[model samples]
Target chain A: MKGNFYLQGFLTFLKIGLFTIGGGYAMIPLIEREVVERRQWLSKEEFLDLMSLSQMLPGVFAVNFSIYIGHRLRGFRGSLALAAGIVVPSFVIILLIAMFFQAFAGNQVVEAIFKGIRPAVVALIAVPCIQLGRVAHITLATAFFPILVAVIIAIAGVSPVYVIIAVAVGAYCYGRFFKEG
Target chain B: MLFLELFCVFFKIGLFGFGGGYAMLSMIQAEVVTSNHWLTSSQFADIVAISQSTPGPIGINSATYSGYISVVNEGYPAIVGILGSLIATVAVVLPSFLLVLLVLKILNHYREHPLTKTIFAALRPTVVGLLLAAVIVLMTKDNFGSVTDTPWQFCVSVFLFLAAFVGTFFYKVHPIRMIILCGLAGFLLYS
Candidate 1:
């Protein structure tokens, strides 16, 4: 593989990694711009498919999505390059912050700011609930599963990993045997 | 030894961390704070708050931040603590990287397979459920004060939560902006 394509891939993701705030979901527009609009590396449809697949996979969404895009574009080497690009910014930035954490941790201003952001973060997480529900096509038939899973985790304090696996198995069985065409 | 433990714990976290960072918090807390006793619950809560406001993915930031704090607390040198952070970050990212490779190789062949479709179809709704569960998990007394313990603080926290939700969902305000506004609100009110 040509070195430049991998380098280009790396730089593209590096930009995304640095600029994206509020985590992976926020990177979508920037990613779309770089991959489709600017680079012309992927089509709109392909981007959408990759987006959904990224969400379904475990681990961070941006990294996972970049892996898919990079692999699809240029196989293993491209994937490696993009992975490094996407992660470098976060790694560097967080490492710096962690190093100074002890110094700034007890700052009254910082504490107060975190106090305000804490509840807002809760709200931030909740806003996505509505959007994701729409994407999942939540209907009466599918409604019970989310409610059941939520109850299991929230009330019973069950580990979510188990709930995820059980839901996948339950859905697979229903689709395979129970659901009619 | 601590390095190995950190890598193993985060690798497992990466493997099962469905529904992104918030969803993974309970598991991370269970392992590092509760299971290993690396950090206290209050400290873990602080890490979550910091991770949310900072750049990068929350999962990656949490892994990096927690890894450093875990080692530093263990009396390791600062350089070793940095190594711990790198290991945790890389380990947390590795599973998804490998999974993507396997997926790209296999999913192409079985893209149309009924079993695959069924599994994915079923997973969609449950993923949302898990995200919801993540929200509930974070709404602890750590993030939101208890009604009796801190009634006035609790009211303000609830107000911020509701405002963020309405602003983002209805008005389509960017989350980054909301975070900044909340920070100002915090400084204004608390400081």
Candidate 2:
């Protein structure tokens, strides 16, 4: 019975993984409907707590969210099953593309299709940046940091690793001395 | 040997990546494209499109694809490319897996800690910058063809780009729809 429950959980995660096109916040409503409403596995509060906790951690948000939910339901076994379910589809699909796409590397029609998608993809990335800025509550005073970062990295070609380290230390110190958290 | 390198690189990506997949794009570009030369800019953009249209996070999708492409591009067999994908996917997942587990014990306390609050608050704007940089870095001739070489295609790219921006940002057109429409437009026009 316990094993079957976790197996079902795995399937649920698999569904989540398979259908969650575009990932990130798009996943929130799906998890809400499936885990909170249909399955009644998590309370609204528990789900919110998990989402925030996942944000504080690193790696994939989808995986982090799954980790919280899985471990809650069945500890380590639940975590493994859900994560595996979530990742397998993406892994398989990309691998298939990798294996097959090169064969069409010279195809004109495929090249044309990709040519159209390419510029659109850049816009897709830009929209999120603007959206994330709003979410971060980026104001004029704080806006300078992000602008400088983009300029240096984009125009001047500085590595992001250095910017990350510098910003972290600088922000921590700014919080300690200039303002409170 | 390249497997080992892929593992190391993705592990570092996992360890440093924050603010989710989009934010991680900066780190991915820094390592996979700029540093390692595993995939070119256009290839990386294609992977981004695939990742978005597919299920799962950009981190995992890019890792898996980059792993396979890197190996295959290196003259490895397709079977070995599978192994490369596995190694990269595992590496990217490993840090966060261990991190979630490690923090599980002190989860409640850690979430409410003042230190965490300060750090997260500080990091929020930084992630915005990272995402911005990801877009800026990706805006290149590689993704949008150079005007000198193909003015018609280049003009079409700029038009499609603006249209997609308005469609996505202002009108909130579904990303999948935008992608498909752009693809169809490409097929109809270019093909």
Candidate 3:
């Protein structure tokens, strides 16, 4: 039974890592399907909590969530296994691409394929932006926060670290003064 | 020594790499391109483009590729370059591992605290904003192409972008399917 937990954790993440494209957010629904519905490793509410907390951390959401879930299921070893399973496919794929990148760098066919995919990537990213906005519940009163942060980072080229820090502090103060009152 | 440096550098990246991979781009640019000079701007752009199209998390993929290129560029052997990739990938995820553990520990106790709720409340909207910024940044000439420089390519890209955006937002087309459709579109039109 103990060994089964580790193997299950490893395989689950391996499948998630292998199949998911378009990065971490893209893995959300599949992850839900596997972790919440199939394995029942985490309940739906628990999974949602993990998702929210995963975003607040620094690294990739996929990895962060993997660690959180793995740790919850087994322990340190389980977390390690899950992380390894999740990262291996990506690490191997990118490494190979980097090694022989010169061969395909200017290849017309590859360039054409990438050119087509680039805009698709943009659209892929935009889907999540809209989804996240809905999840964040951006009302008129609170809409300025997102707009201000976007302008400061994207337009002004300010460091995102400072913006996140400022927003966090501002929110804390807002909560203390308004919500608590 | 190079491996240690690679580890430390990526560890820092992981600790502060908010908003996922895209938000982490500026920080990575600062560290690898400007501060360390490990990769040039064009190389950075190439890595971003490639990583975006490839599998896995963009942050992890970039770290793996960047670490390898950084080490190999330093007169290291190919074998050493592989080691560099492994080191960077592990070190990049380590901080998050520790952090998530710590958060679980602390938040377990503060599960019901209003202050905790307040912190997340602010973070939620900010994350959304950061994601929006990532979209806008990618829409630039570098990722999409400039209109004046190459009118045809630019027009196709814009059309694809609008088509994809609408397809995703209104039609709810799966992203992978969109990728396939766009790949075919690019191949037929450009190739």
Runs off by more than 4 Å, candidate 2: A177-181
Model 1, runs deviating above 4 Å: A40-52, A139-144, A179-181, B20-53, B73-77
Question: Which one is best on TM-score?
Answer: 2
In lDDT terms, how accurate is model 3?
0.79
- Among all windows of 10 consecutive residues in model 1 chain B, the one with the lowest summed lDDT is B40-49
Task: Write model 3 residue lDDT over A70-111, tens digit each, in one string.
Answer: 887787788888888889899999999998974566788877
Model 2, CA-based lDDT: 0.84
Error of 3 at B99 (Å): 1.6
Q: Each model's C-alpha lDDT?
A: 0.82, 0.84, 0.79
lDDT of 2 by residue, B1-191 (tens): 89899999899888778788888877888788877888889888888888888877788898898998889888988899899999999999888778867866786676676665777777778888887888888888888878899888889999999999999999999988999999999999999
Write candidate 1's Cα lDDT for A1-181 as tens digits.
Answer: 4778998999989999899877888889999999999999999999999898887678888889898998899987888899889889989988888788756868999888878888887777677776878887887787787888777876777766677688778877787787654
RMSD of each: 3.1, 1.9, 3.8
Model 3 Cα shift for residue A12 (angstroms): 4.4
Error of 1 at A172 (Å): 2.7
**Of the native A-B interface contacts, what share survives in model 3?**
0.73
